[model samples]
Target: MTIALRRDEAGSGPIVERIEGGGFRTQEHYFADGVMLTPRRAETWAGTHDAAMLDRAAIGQLLAIWGEGLPEFIVLGTGSTQIFPSGALRRALESEGIGLEIMDSRAAARAWSVLRAEDREIAALLLPLA
Candidate 1:
């Protein structure tokens, strides 16, 4: 299934034009399986297509993209439905001063659109909607 999201022709990273099967389509690229969007860039995130594998360690790997410059929060899209992460994971992010916002891919895409338009300094990890 293909879910059409906000088409931001003028925004930076995390601008999702649509979400196709097992991937997301931006204006400039189609990220297969998953994608990571940082304040400075957006790139394909391999092996994150499964939302069930989301864990504290998984988030740590994703945060590697930030290096030392972490975002205020991370918008995490859990496939086609909202799947809450473990409390430990939430607390872990909080301890690191990073908020974890979990949502379905659809809502995540919309939120990303709004946030990107506002130029919010945030990062995102979007799992495919398959």
Candidate 2:
């Protein structure tokens, strides 16, 4: 299956326009694997896509998204399932004043589009759906 978003206007960040098996399509390019997205840029993530394998150090690196400007929150797209993170990881983000939101990759992609439309200060890690 494929999920798509309608682009009504231009924006700064790379919007998630389409999400399909094993990849995502943005206005800029197509990501064949997991991706990290910030309000400023999007890049390929070489880290583990399994949410169960994610740790504090893994998420902490997201702070480098825009080089010094941290996001207000983070969206963790855990592949095809909505795997919740450890309490320790959540607390760590809370201590840094960053909220953590977890969902399946497809949902996270759609959510990123909505939040970015409002110009919210956010970042996301989207694992491939298939």
Candidate 3:
């Protein structure tokens, strides 16, 4: 489904208006900027895409790079299933003052849209099913 703010609500910066595609797919469409991304082992921070996956090392690296504009929490979409991260990974994120929520892609998409609409500081790192 499409998620967009009203014309008047469109601020000066970029916003993830909507997300399309799910269910065992390797790619998803972001309607805001009209880009199709395949985050197989990657991360999408706000509108910035990266080639990182959900792993202990990757999570640590991401946390290191996260600066002042860090998200209050992150929504991790584990492909077609909800896969929780390892304890180490969870601790790492918590230590960095970031909350992590695990869910399937479909749920993640809906949650991300809702959080964005509420103007919350959030990011999504999704892994699409092969």
Candidate 4:
């Protein structure tokens, strides 16, 4: 028996695929009337059980985009199945008058999508699964 491939238009928006072979290559694409907006390219990272491995640069990029907005809240994903925030990081954000929540990457992605769909420009730091 063979399983048939089904095409899903739902949530299929502009896709920016990052292919990693001998090296990494990024490609941007657009989807019409789909669930997402413009394409975005992101670099993939190795996942570790330790939250200390979180990439600050990636987090910074997301913050830079919504920094001017100075959202009341921000969400971050630590990758893998673990989600937690460093004390120093939290303190820094608080000092800047921004509240933050940390969760697994998967949850963060879903929450970001939901919040973004609401038309709110909430900043999200998501660690994509490799």
Model 3 CA lDDT for position 25:
25
Off by over 4 Å in 2: 8-11
Local error of candidate 1 at residue 26 (angstroms): 1.3
Name the regions of candidate 3 deviating beyond 4 angstroms: 1-53, 60-67
Model 1 lDDT tens row, 46-75: 765667667777876678887677788999
- Compute each candidate's TM-score over C-alphas: 0.86, 0.91, 0.58, 0.54
Candidate 3: residue 120 Cα off by (Å): 0.5
Instruction: Look at candidate 1 and give me any clashing residue pairs.
Output: none
**TM-score of decoy 1:** 0.86
lDDT tens readout by residue for model 2, 9-95:
534588888887778888888887888899888888777777887887887556666577678899989988899878888888888
lDDT of 4 by residue, 1-130 (tens): 1112222234332222221221122234221111111113233333333456444443454455442456667666655455565677677778878777787655555555555455554555545433
Evaluate residue 111 in candidate 4 and report its C-alpha lDDT on the 0 to 100 scale: 59
Clashes of each: 0, 0, 1, 0
lDDT of 3 by residue, 1-130 (tens): 4333332242222333333443222123233211222111223433222223345566544444444466688777665577776777777778878888888755675565566556666656655432
Highest TM-score: give the candidate number: 2
Instruction: State how far residue 27 of model 1 sits from its true place (Å).
Output: 2.1
Clashing pairs in 4: none
List ranges where model 1 is wrong by over 4 Å.
8-10
Overall local distance difference test of candidate 3: 0.49
Minimum summed lDDT over a 10-residue window in model 1 is located at 5-14
Residue 36 of model 3, lDDT score: 21
